[model samples]
Target: MKKKLKFNRDWCKGCGICVEFCPKNVLELDDELKIYAPRSGDCIFCKMCELRCPDIAIQIIETQEESDEEK
Candidate 1:
């Protein structure tokens, strides 16, 4: 299974809690202090960031990649 990460920019308060708590180091803060998923490819869908986010800005959802049969 694949994991997709989404961020609610409007709800985010630029806190680093999500970035600091991500076990896979999949999250980071930009120069402007906004949170971003720079290494999302390394995400393991642990949901640590999502659960720990004070602003409820981070979300992790499981997804299935499109297969040849779906094309």
Candidate 2:
């Protein structure tokens, strides 16, 4: 299974909390104070960014492709 995190630049405040907390170094802040998912596949669905963001700009979603047998 793989997970993804998406950043809403407009809502981000350029805070580095997410970048600092991510164990995989998956996120980086741009000059405009917005966050970007530099390493999307490295995310472990920790949800730390989603929970800690003050502006509610980060979202994490699971993207496990269901096998044909499961379907």
Candidate 3:
């Protein structure tokens, strides 16, 4: 049940809002001001970044295989 967060550098404005809002400190701003996912494992699946991103550049995807029994 690992979730991954992807960042679109082209849309990022380097506002650092995502970095500031991330409770797990999973995101950081590089010299270019683009937000990068430094520690993705630390992400708590809290859509804080995704919801707060003004540029709408952040996307969180949950990757889990559904059990056939459940299906």
TM-score between candidate 3 and the true structure:
0.81
lDDT of each: 0.76, 0.75, 0.80
TM-score for each of the candidates: 0.78, 0.76, 0.81
TM-score winner: 3
lDDT of 3 by residue, 1-71 (tens): 64668778899999999999889998899889898876766778799999999999998865574421110
True lDDT of residue 10, candidate 3: 95
Give the per-residue lDDT digits (tens) of candidate 1, residues 1-71.
65578788878888898887778887888887878887766777788888998898887655686421110
lDDT of 3 at 5: 80
Where does candidate 1 clash, by residue pair?
Answer: none
lDDT digits (tens) for residues 1-71 of candidate 2: 54567677788898799889988888888777688876766777789989999899898755675421110
The TM-score between candidate 1 and the true structure equals 0.78
Q: Quick one: how many clashes does candidate 1 have?
A: 0
Candidate 2, run of 10 with poorest lDDT: 62-71
Model 1 poorest ten-residue lDDT run: 62-71
